[model samples]
Target: MSSDPGEPARRALERARQSIQKIHQAAIRHRDPSLHEIADEMSEVALILGHDAGPVQDWRPCPVCGAEPGSHCIQRPGHEMVNGMHPERSRL
Candidate 1:
């Protein structure tokens, strides 16, 4: 094959494109908020409005973000790790 100096950059751009696509997929897959945390936040809002407290319940850690305090972070399960240009799903 004839050597082309731009081949490496082209390949790099393609790799970057694939990587960005994987991130996009991950974000789309994990865009929902936690229902439990939603309720908690609603309760806080109610209190601000002079209403009764919202429902209080134990915070459950997302499997992807294990052991972290409730911040309602998105959980993509096995997608936390990179496998090639895509994220590998967690089997846990």
Candidate 2:
């Protein structure tokens, strides 16, 4: 299915949240609590999804350093464009 750039990222975030919720429910059913680990995993997933989403609003924080927005955090440059290709074109 074709989707806008932001659409796919949002979908990924939704999927990650759904997966986390399922894990929570499974934990409850199995009587084995691993909520902390589940939460950590969710956070990691969300962070990755957010990065993939790109700069929607503004550069909030340095994803690597977790520094506050507007702080002098080192920013990793986005992917370089291939010759004759538009900036939005995906290499994938």
Candidate 3:
């Protein structure tokens, strides 16, 4: 067993990223018009899965909870973490 608690998640994410890369390469080799579309979609998925995706939207702080940029907003006392980011935060 691995000692690191996040090892599983890290491995899964890496695998997904690699799969996307392979699919993109295959699409390029085929040279079909539809394959080009698939390649574009895979490129978008790669960007979203990249390390730069850690941040929320903008660099500004959350208007509601004042959560700093790159950090998720804090939930209310009875709210779940999934609901933490305030709707107002996206307005920026």
Best by lDDT: 3
Pairs that collide, model 3: none
lDDT of each: 0.42, 0.44, 0.54
Candidate numbers, best TM-score first, in rank order: 3, 2, 1
Cα lDDT of model 2 by residue, 14-91, tens digit: 776666555545554565546524544555565665533222111132344443322344333563323422233211
TM-score of each: 0.32, 0.41, 0.41
**Candidate 3 lDDT by residue in tens digits, 1-36:** 999999998887677656654554454455443643
Candidate 1 has an lDDT of 0.42
Residues 16-91, candidate 1: write the lDDT tens digits: 4454344433433565335434544545565666554421221333355443323344445465533321221121
Best by TM-score: 3
Stronger candidate by lDDT (2 vs 3): 3
Q: Considering summed lDDT, which 10 consecutive residues are worst modelled in model 3?
A: 51-60
| Model 2 stretches astray by more than 4 angstroms | 1-3, 44-92
Worst 10 residues of 2 by lDDT: 53-62
lDDT of 2 at 68: 37
Better candidate number, 1 or 3, judged by TM-score: 3
